[model samples]
Target: MLKPGGILLLTTHGDITRQNLLPDEQQKFDAGELVVRGNVKEGHRMYTAYHPVKYMNTLFDHKVTVLKHKAGTRQSWGLEQDLWLLQKGNS
Candidate 1:
C-alpha cells in the first residue's frame, strides 16, 4: 500500500564490481572456509549478483511507475560503491 503523491526511494549496489568481497580478502575475514563477512564489508570488492536497472524497471512496471532513476559509483576510503534512486508515481 502507498499514499497519493508520496515518495518511494530505494537504492542498491549497481554492479557486480561494486558489490561482494574479493577472494583473498574474503579468506582473511572468513569465520570458516565457506563464510565471508557482509557484502559491504571493508576490503570486499566482488559482486556475487547483479540486478541491473532494466530488471528493476521490469519488476516495477504497472505496479509503480518510475518518476526518476539515477545510477553511479561512489568513491570513499579508497573503495567504490554503487548508488541508485527510484521513485514511484504520484497519483
Candidate 2:
C-alpha cells in the first residue's frame, strides 16, 4: 500500500534474456559446460527476471505515474542498473 504522495522506487538489472546476450557471451556459456555446469554462482540468487526498459513501460503503464527514471552503474558489482521512481495513479 502507498499514500497519495508516497514514492515508490525500484532498482533492477538490465536485459538478461538469451536474445540480449552477445556472441562472446555465447562462447562463455559453452566454456562453462564442465566446471560451472549445474552449479550455482557465489552471490547470485536462484531465480531472477531480466526485464527490458520497454517491458518496464508496459508493466507500469497506466498503473503508475512515473516521476523520474535514472540509469547508472552499481558501485558494489560495477554493473549497470536502472532506477525508477513512480507514484500510484488514481483509480
Candidate 3:
C-alpha cells in the first residue's frame, strides 16, 4: 500500500500485445483480463496484462493522481508497454 503523497510506478502490456495474440487468445484479450501462457521451458509460464490509458485513468479516479501516462515500445521483446506514474491522495 502507498502512504499519502507516495508515488507509484507501474508498467503493463499495451495494445501491441493484443495485436500479437494468438487467434484463440483474442477473445480473452477482448474481455479485459490478463492472459497467461505456458512457456516452452518446463514449469514456467508468462503472464500479460494490458490496460488502455482511459481505463487506467478511470481506475485511479478518486484514489491517486496520475502524474504521467505513456506508451512505450520494447523492440527486443517485440512488445509495447504502458507506463504510469501515480501519486497517492492526501485523503
Candidate 4:
C-alpha cells in the first residue's frame, strides 16, 4: 500500500481507444465501467484496459487527492492515453 501523502502517477487508455471499442464495450464504458480485454497478451494494444474518467473517480475517490488528470494526444502509434497524478491520503 502507498504511504499517506505518497504520490502515484500512471496512465490508461482513453479517448482515442474509446473510439475503437465495440458497441457493447462502449455502452459499458459510457456507463462508467472499466472495460478490460483479457484475451490477448497483457501489454498488447489489442489487450488494453480502457479507463473512463467517471469510473476512475469512483475507484479512487476519498482515497487519494487527484492532483492532475491529462488526456494525451495521439502518441502511442496514433493511440492516446490519459495520465493521472494522485496523492495518497488518510481516508
Candidate 5:
C-alpha cells in the first residue's frame, strides 16, 4: 500500500496501439474489454497491456491524484507512450 502523499509513476502503451497495430490486432483490441498482447519474437513470450488516456485516468481515480498525464510518440521508436505521475491520497 502507498502512504499518503507518496508518488507513483507509470508508463504504458498509448493511443498509438490503435494506429500501429495490424487490422486483426486492432479488431481484437476493439472487442476486448482489456487488451493484452504477447511478444512472440522475444523467445520469452511476454505480454503487454495498452490503454487510452481516459481509461488510464479512470483506473487510478480512486487511489491517487493525478499530477500529470502525458501522451506522445517518441521520435526514435515512433511509438506512443503514456506517462502518468500520481500522488497517493489520504483516504
Candidate 6:
C-alpha cells in the first residue's frame, strides 16, 4: 500500500480516449463503466483499458485525497488521458 501522505501521480485513458472504441464499448464507458481493448497475447500498449471519471474516483473512494483531476486533449492518433494527482489517506 502507498504510505500515508504519500503523493501519487498517474495518467490513464479517459472519456476523450473513447472515440477509438467500438459503439458498445463507448456506450459502456459513457455509462460510467470501464472499457478495455486489445488481445491478451499482445504487448502492453496493445492491450489497454480505461476507466470513467466517476468509476475511477470510486476505486479510491475515501482512501485518498484527490489533489487534481484533468483530462488531456486528444492526440493525433486519437489518444487522450486523464491525469490524477493524489495523496494517500493518513488512516
Per-residue lDDT of candidate 4, residues 12-79 (tens digit)? 88766788789999999999899998766566655668988899999998889999999867764787
- Give the whole-model CA lDDT for all candidates, comma-separated: 0.51, 0.59, 0.72, 0.85, 0.73, 0.84
Q: How does candidate 2 score on lDDT?
A: 0.59
Can you list the residue pairs that collide in candidate 2? none
CA displacement after TM-score superposition, residue 38 of candidate 6 (Å)? 3.8
User: Sorted on lDDT, highest at the top, how do the candidates line up?
Assistant: 4, 6, 5, 3, 2, 1
RMSD (Cα, Å) of candidate 1? 8.9
For 41-89, candidate 6 gives per-residue lDDT tens digits of: 5555567888889888888789898899988686788666789999997
TM-score of candidate 1 on Cα atoms, chains taken together: 0.47
Candidate 1 Cα misplacement greater than 4 A, ranges: 16-50, 78-91
* lDDT (Cα, 0-100) at 19 in candidate 1: 39
**Candidate 2 regions with alpha-carbon error over 4 angstroms:** 15-45, 74-77
lDDT of 5 by residue, 17-87 (tens): 67766687676556543456788456787777767666666677787898998886667767767788989
lDDT of 2 by residue, 1-85 (tens): 8876668998755433323345664454334321122224577655444445666777778778889877655466656667889
Ranked by TM-score, the better of candidates 2 and 6 is 6
- Per-candidate clashes come to 2, 0, 0, 0, 0, 0
Give the top-scoring candidate (lDDT). 4
| TM-score of each predicted structure versus truth | 0.47, 0.57, 0.67, 0.83, 0.73, 0.83
Ranking by TM-score: 6, 4, 5, 3, 2, 1
Q: Candidate 5 versus the native: TM-score? A: 0.73
Superposed Cα deviation of residue 24, candidate 3 (Å):
6.4
lDDT of 1 by residue, 1-73 (tens): 6675556776644443333546674443232222223456467764343345555666778767676666645
lDDT of 6: 0.84
Against the true structure, candidate 3 reaches a TM-score of: 0.67
